[model samples]
Target chain A: MNQEQFEIYRHLAGRLIDGQLSPGSHIESEQELARKFSTTRMNAYRAIKQLERRGIVSRSKRAGTRVSAPVNPNLLRQLKCEMTRRICVIHSRNSYEYLHWTGEFRRTLQQALAAEDFTLEDVHLDDVRDRAELKEKLLRLTETGIAAFILSVRGEEDEFLIENSDLFFQYHNKIFVYQSGAMSWMHWPFHTVTVNIFGEGSLAAKYLMEKGIRKIAYCRREISSKNYLDFNRERLLGVEFTMRRLSDGRNKPEEWVGLEQIYRNCMENGSGCGLIVSTDELAARIIDYFAERGAKRPPEMISFDNNSEYDSYRLTTIAPPHVEMAQTLGRLIFDNIDIDSECGFVSYIKIDSKLIINHQE
Target chain B: MNQEQFEIYRHLAGRLIDGQLSPGSHIESEQELARKFSTTRMNAYRAIKQLERRGIVSRSKRAGTRVSAPVNPNLLRQLKCEMTRRICVIHSRNSYEYLHWTGEFRRTLQQALAAEDFTLEDVHLDDVRDRAELKEKLLRLTETGIAAFILSVRGEEDEFLIENSDLFFQYHNKIFVYQSGAMSWMHWPFHTVTVNIFGEGSLAAKYLMEKGIRKIAYCRREISSKNYLDFNRERLLGVEFTMRRLSDGRNKPEEWVGLEQIYRNCMENGSGCGLIVSTDELAARIIDYFAERGAKRPPEMISFDNNSEYDSYRLTTIAPPHVEMAQTLGRLIFDNIDIDSECGFVSYIKIDSKLIINHQE
Candidate 1:
């Protein structure tokens, strides 16, 4: 798409030739690489997606992007099998407990690797932020013969790294990201763990309607995320669809309550309200708030699970199949499917949530 | 006391002097080492306990054994500081998510640590049967320059480790374990986050008595834990104390109800009953089980909290302070206290629990 992206592709291809980037290894996210090269997320995504299309990597929603397995003999035949390939795992400090599932996953991975006589060196970096620090760490990994990396990047900071995919490629390292949607602006070869946000939203709406709730409110945080916005639009559409089915040409409702406006409305009204909370934790908090303030509870409140260990509110929620998702991702990484090929690839995987009704609200 | 213990102490002292052992690192449990070394739990406990008495290590209920912080050569040259240099953290992971306010305490610990520039590394080994894998991982950490470890050991496994502390110490590690009265027989400490079972049980009993429930059934899981047994015994004592104060030395109740048996008895007799379930999960399960089976609901039921995330049951529960505990433990670790000293040590820290009354009990 651009000179920088082309350069990145060249460098990445060179690494594949030199065996520096091996099969079944995970690369850094587009955001991480963009930051490293001081560029845009668009460019970075372009470079990576191109590589992916070339069968260099495989991507999924929960597993992020990873190097395809089945070694390309022309690329790695010269390297020793026991060189102790180093891999870096970067995660936010606050997410330590939530990510503990990784520990168990890692153990299982290690055992699997050991069975095949492959040695792995893992380096865990916690509370990582700042582009310079990230670059320094990546450089260190390279200096120490690190073959690949796994990162969970957060926020808008990813944009910078996406633009610099060419620079990353020049260094003979592959980069991958864990995103849930198509980056229409970028044509680079990269992999991602994409979720069916639209479908999930529709399901939420349908579930609420089934409970005999006509007046509904949707609550979400103020943060801007493409995934969140996509889900919101889809959920609204689903609600409208259900409403239209029931109304028989009746007039549409005039007001839609936002999260900030929920408390006032809840306090003012006694009943006949249904709420679809964006996340379970938030729903719990809202329930607790209402309880403390002596407000009448809603007839039905639905929430989405985000792998939290504690729920602040006693409510009915839809839980994601986290374990199943984790396992599927693990299998994909272990298998190392070709990114370019559509044959035998799982294009989409959607999980359903169950209704767990509690007594509190 | 025994040959194995004598050797363990000898090895422990060597590790301390060599700087291979660090302050606040957890050692193997008495039962664990004993099994590994083909010795008895008492032998292992005696050795570690002897070291503890000599100011070489520090031990507590669930916290496991740990090497006291060594005096900094620089500090030693200046002036003597009387501070206890050991750090201890006691944690409990039980399915009883509704019990004892454990989760709340953990959060408090996290907040406290956040105020400082330190982070906690948690490795949750859900079951003790994975000890060999745990040991391997621990050894790998040591190789990767991790100086201390915290863990929770369970069952007869405590004796094996304590008896074989010599081998463990030689590997350059320390441990702390929680202990409470005669129940030391259940000492299976790797490194634990302990709870005040006796105190909490007594409080629960007192609260129920105040609510006018004289014939209360203690509903517990089929496979009980040491904490459960301890809490039940203490609660019984408290209930007895309260009854003594209220009665004129005439009425004495002999029958107590276990969870399963209570259901059968109630069904056969059509009697109204009040219940105190061991943990929240169990309580929720009991409710679900009855509702599904078309059994009449109990009049009143109370349960303990381990701060579980599932709120599907929403029964009345005693909420633990897990957040606080996690925060506290994080701070203690960051402070870098010396475990070898007895002076200036806080013997025990207990947080109060609150009752959250919900319907559908």
Candidate 2:
């Protein structure tokens, strides 16, 4: 068979073996298949005939072509084994933000990896009872020559991996640590990708100030103490630094750190000022405040993380570059480029933050 | 082997076959495993030996027991086949709310089904190119004696299923139609479950009124034209009906159906009144308004769909009972209870809505 014909056969067989198509089901007509593959009808027929010779499909005058039940299940196993290039995605179990981690980021990463012919397998570290089992799983993946590993984990839950960093030093190059927070350890030397939280704050500040606002308030809810690095503090510092630099160290924006404080500030001077919100959730509450007041024009506002749930609010937001980060990691895996060497001993990669305007897609 | 020993052996083998336990990886110590299973070390050791005998694991004094590479991959197929009780969850591809549908609901359903030793598999209808392919899939599943199927589809995307309703009538008993919107076809005979949108509105109005709300307003963003039933309109009707009945047909709440209208209403007479919002998102904007005004006390507000993203807003919301619905569906599967028989020809089930106060866990 020609290369294109061979590809058609492989694609059809792969779909069947992957359970995308069921046994004994009527296959699409040859003309439809040809249209689908952008191939000639003769070629599609040839592919079907090739499958028929192997007992994979049967053609009948009365019914048309139909997929047959596998005569040998071993072929399924063999086909599965042939797709050995896999990227292992490891994460903590029972993560409250599990959905967030597995949502857009996971989908984008999976799509990016699939484009490179690498399958993504999820391995929950806490799914197993003990640290030993987790280690064993990692060891097995490395032994199997897995292409790359992405560690998408949260605070404290990542303690095991951090503690065992030395053990993984041998395969450090193959590991990518992805966390939204600031990196705690600089010495581990594993390839790291993190959302530029500080940059996001700066971007929000810069964006709002450039819009020619006379005054602004930096609003945040009470900071959670659970994180190893205070992301809010870092973000606040970024905003403060930018605000100072932009105004030649002559101006400081208001900081509304708690609900009561925010309320007091809004009550006293909330009108017509630019606002830099810490997160989308916080921005949502602020939007509600202005909306209820029946303000003719809502204040110029910018927040971090463009959550789709808050899309209608039309709040411009500094969003984490999830897709860009995913694609960058994919490039790292396929190209085997050493990030540290490329960046003069910078171990971690800080993906530039994104500013989504008025919730535009 | 005793029953406990057999269970331990089976559990280990299942883990191995499921790829939860990696091949050639060191197994947890027998004592630790015994502690885990609450069994004696002797039983655990006996189970290990049984696995060793079957060439699934190997034991050595120096390195301890290790899972062995599968000598016969056919055993994997046999074990997989043994899990014949499966629920197929079908949805549209490129569904914008795909994550929402697949997130909490899918997880809860999977957990509920797993409790009954059943597995859930996802099938995207739009992934296939043609209706013939889709029909073939359903036919194959039926031929294989599949346990159940859940159709979690949106408006126009469900046209194919609705059009082919006659073809599916024979398997109506095993088909479940799950949608948040109102069902368009009451006569389809497939078991239906929908969120109580009207009841949610009534409950919100009732809850606010009972709390001595002097004035209440039913607030909603612009109603989308996409839905089969005007959910917002129904919700408003429920609120109005409840308001009038509670106040002896004398009181009617204000209606703010659009953003501009809501803003005008809030600006004119928004304060010190309870608000019944159509969604958590709209409620967020209202909350933001009050917070900005620096009102010492926020207005009593109730909204629909207790989205976690709006948890901080602390708006009392009518939440779809996801876990309860999942459990109910699971019970339906296990008992094979015919709804039509039990409810006097009522084929559909309405799971009660939940009211979340201040985002309580």
The best candidate by lDDT is 2
Task: Give the alpha carbon lDDT tens digit for every residue of B1-361 in model 2.
Answer: 5656756766776787668887778887899889989999998998887667656788888978887766344345333322246677777553434423747777877887787567888777765666567656766655444556777754323456655543343332456767665544333434566555555666788788788785888877665554423556656756776676566456678876765566556667756677787778878876676566654323566887777777777778887767766666566555543211222122244445777788433
Question: Local distance difference test, per candidate?
Answer: 0.48, 0.63
RMSD in angstroms, candidate 2?
Answer: 28.8
Q: For model 2, what is the C-alpha lDDT against the true structure?
A: 0.63
Residue-level lDDT for A81 in candidate 1: 17
Error of 2 at A228 (Å): 6.6
Backbone clashes under 3 angstroms, per model: 124, 5
Lowest summed lDDT window (length 10), candidate 2 chain A: A337-346
| All candidates: TM-score | 0.34, 0.35
Docking class of 2: incorrect
| Candidate 2 lDDT, A1-361, residue by residue in tens | 5545655776776787768777688888889889989999998888787778656788899989887766344345333332245667777553435423747777887887777467888877656666566556655656454556677755333566655553343332456677766544233334566666656776777787777775778887775554533566567656765666565455567777765566556667756677788777788886666567664333577887777777777778887777767766676555542211222121245566777888343
Return the number of clashes found in candidate 2: 5
Interface quality of candidate 1 as DockQ: 0.01
What is the interface RMSD, in angstroms, for predicted model 1?
Answer: 32.6
lDDT of 2 at B139: 60
